[model samples]
Target: MKKHLIAITLILLLIAGGVIFYLAQGDKAKLAAGADTGKEPVFTAPRSELIPTINVAEVKVWTAGEKPVAAKGLALARFADGLAHPRSMLVLPNGDILVAETNSPPRPSGGLVDRVMNYLMNKAGAGVPSANRITLLRDADGDGRAEVKTPFLTGLNSPYGMALVDGTLYVANTDALMAFPYKEGETRITAKGRKILNLPANAPNMHWTKSLTAGPTGLLYVGVGSNSNIAEDGLEGEANRAAVLEVNPRTGDYRIYASGLRNPVGLAFEPKSGALWGVVNERDMLGSDLVPDYLTRIEFGGFYGWPWNYWGGYEDRRVQPQRPEVREYTKRPDYALGNHVAPLGLAFADKVKIGGAFANGAFVGLHGSWNRKPAAGYKVVFVPFAANGEVSKAKPVDVLTGFLDADGHARGRPVDVAGDAKGALLVSDDVGGVIWRVTGGK
Candidate 1:
């Protein structure tokens, strides 16, 4: 009788798994892929799922001679290769490049849901252990490729963002902001990093990556993500999170500069107006088309809706004890990059000499999506900005393609974008472990 009972339970579990797989596959995207992109995208009604759509592209790293397709009149070449999940970058004053080859820290197992999500992420080329180091890539011969690649700094905790200010290098690790003294043309740093400030990095850090940038006034800005998706862990856990914090490097003091940005992974300053801007990844599980990720100018003390509202006051009814009043002050983003594009990098085109339509715009690295079916955003795109440093109503132009192959497998996934000393664009492909240089064609 015990044997029979055990057999029956196993069969039931299999049946349940099959049912879930069917439901997940059945949640097809109703709107077209790029329909929810641009200044005013179509906001379809919410189609929340008990099990959100799980359409992840399997990872197949590029073999020899494989490369992404550049846009018309643009040339592509490998800048540096054989990296380990290079997520962010900083080009030094002396033309040396620093690549933060890192990933998420170890996460505690949170029952079956967390385990399942981990499995899915592993399949999507994101489950590897953190590299915990930053590498220096130097091109001494004047060629585009880096002939000297060496470890610049080590013993970090999933460092993501990097900046050099006033002869000091600041790195945003998953849990702390660290600083190290540096000089021009230094290939490596052997000194220990001083902890400038502690960031919000509680356990099960859903959005673990912290982006950073230095303003002209020498103040540092760090972007911190929320602890939970839609405040499921309660609002208390999100204190000083989901916002950008301004820090004084001299004294280690910091304050919340802006609040309620869900996951501002990429922080940059517009050269013309000198205003801060960011690309945010919105909430998930609202079907494939509900919440569109955006790029916008981040104002001081500004609030872009998160758990309470989205897209300029569209309430997300999922949160318990919703703050209906929060909608009144919710600021809409300037431009939407479509739903679940997962933009992770933002760079202005002010110093970029890649002429033509790419001259006066912003280059964004859309890291691609896993929660939405008919996945979006595996390439880099250019969003044109006006002469006054404002993003226009025009749609984004694709700058790099072919990350996803014909069979929907990802050969590479773009993470961060930055302009090099020579005025060319450098894109980091974490999955393929390469930095690609895009320049004007001959």
Candidate 2:
């Protein structure tokens, strides 16, 4: 009996070793990063994985005197430091900056897969509890660094996007759209928040960050991500999700502005044509260079492919109950920012005075990727745009870099990018707890 038990144990160990070997030999990218970028990206065939590649960079906070490298002819400075996990920023009408210093809400435990992912995420410096507040930063002396930092709004639930429309500030929390009365030059909001709309944030909210932007007509557009990766949680679980919603702030009524976006994190309106645009994080586990995250014009009542298809009708066999009809209407994205870039923030350069190549374009904050080998997108990039509000054919140009050290340990991870009143770019580094300012040469 003892010999038999030993044989069984040895067999189990052999099986585990085999599984590890297979996962270690997971799909690799044959094409370079730029090959899967720009207006005509080369999409490779999907190489789905039973266990996706997990190559998260261990977090290492930046020491004093350390900062990101700006492009040639540009300068980088610390706008605000020593803050909680800052995710997004909004430039108030009075030139004050409001940053949402928050993190993910408490997530319920799943099975073994989720347990492993949680452990990896924590190691990547994203496990901290939500700060649940927006902090105000004022650079009153005009020296780039913030002089007065104070709590602007407190006791909120993982707030992210913020927009001021018609004297009211709209905050998109993880599960609801909140509104508060506001006035110019005020540092704090003592008024009670009104819950304008409840967003889709059910249990296991895989993508919980809701980005808000105001349209030209005073309508509010909110970017709601998918409940699950590729809708594996059943179609019923994705009702009104994976799409951008236009909300009426007064009546709390909303409609699906566009459908089939996997995770639209950043929304902005083009300055020239006033067309709404968004940066979408595409589906993962399809190898490293298959599906590229994209920036595209958000047309009303339009559909971009999600679970069923990708990159304009490239069918994903893994998604069940395939709707072949949906492929006919899948709108091809305008520009590909590269696969697994994880773009989070989008701001046009209409107000940005950074000259030369940075003159006419949009700034994107790439939050970095955990699934891709060699790690991609821990920096800020600028995608050039034409004068007519169309995306140029040029590949994205790096604006800020060196977030990772020689050992590939992440010193910081950028989350959002917005232009300050003085025409400089403000980048929120969530992991390093700093907001970096980038200005062009004099």
Candidate 3:
């Protein structure tokens, strides 16, 4: 009698599992059919008009100087176009490029309402036109070119940074830390996973994309931007905004890893030292030199003062009567990029072995500056790290440039950078709506 009961239960369980699998497959088919079909997508959050990345009518190769090929070592091979605002990129283990389009325009160009919408979002503390889907591009045929395209994930809220852990995909979406359950060869995000954690305060009255990176231990770290450039700064109000939070994808457990960082857009774990590193975009509206963007290692519970002190000893007069009691422990950034140079994308380049100046260095994509008297940072630069994984009196080399033209105009603004499984660095341009994959080292 007991054996008979067990057999019946086993048969029922098998049937239920098969049904779930069939339903999942059907859902993927429906999602893929809708993705990138140029159809209007429904959303869970409020929609606004501020699309930033411009989709070029044609893919053109641009060089810094008039000679077109003046820089022999550096060349931008445009991989794909028609992206709304390709803010962040994740090169998959299988060589497919996953691009997060942040705030792409509807009609493909700016409209009056769209511009107003963007402005209002910025004013109200949430800003920019953001992408709702993740795009997958593959050169499946190996024809020395890529012609295949597919939408991998959709309804993501301005997803910025992507980290693949074990088999799961962890995305840092603005206002939330999200996850996609996965396994090898899975086409769709079959499982919704978890919202994990929600961060409403990171809404950018200023700069907002909450980029994230996973470390060696399967721990996910997120970057939450400030409510405004350097306004009230939520010194004691919002705890996690303008800070980095380390998270566990499976369990949805989280903790504040660091604080007082204003918009740490890009983050990575050091290959040699196993330390967490981040590149931050400091506040604006002071002078070009007042608040310099920074790239530094993230220390737990460390404070890099914002709305008060910036780049170490430079006290910001705008936020006068600064907190005198809590100023001692502020750890100044190890190094500073040029003033107003918005450094965002970062990756520890141990895997990609390049010779010459950048043989043993990291690459940072400087998303061009806004409100600067002189425009700054529309290129990818290299910073050499010593044997100890620290910057040792090094200067940055321009690896990717020409986004700003001869007339000092910006063709595109770079947002994020990542290395492929083969060590090729990929740069995503939000302004140009394009993706450029840079391969260095054999």
- Highest-scoring model, lDDT: 1
Worst ten in a row by lDDT for model 2: 109-118
- Show the colliding residue pairs in model 2: none
Q: State TM-scores per candidate.
A: 0.95, 0.94, 0.76
The runs of at least 3 residues in candidate 3 whose Cα sits more than 4 Å from the true structure, single-residue gaps closed, are 1-71, 104-128, 142-144, 201-205, 233-237, 440-442
Mark the regions of model 1 whose C-alpha exceeds 4 Å error after superposition: 1-20
lDDT of 1 by residue, 50-84 (tens): 78777889999999799999999999999999999
Winner on lDDT between 2 and 3 is 2
Candidate 2 lDDT score relative to the true structure: 0.90
Better of 1 and 2 by lDDT: 1
Cα error of candidate 3 at position 261, Å: 0.5
Clashing residue pairs in candidate 3 are 50-129, 102-130, 102-131, 103-129, 103-130, 103-131, 125-204, 125-205
Tens digits of lDDT, candidate 3, 346-428: 87677554446666767888876553434567788888888877776656767877776766656666778776655566677
User: Candidate 3's error at 304, in angstroms?
Assistant: 0.9
Q: For residues 125-154, could you state the per-residue lDDT of candidate 2 as single tens digits?
A: 998899999999999999999999999999
Residue 324 CA displacement from its true place in model 2, Å? 0.8
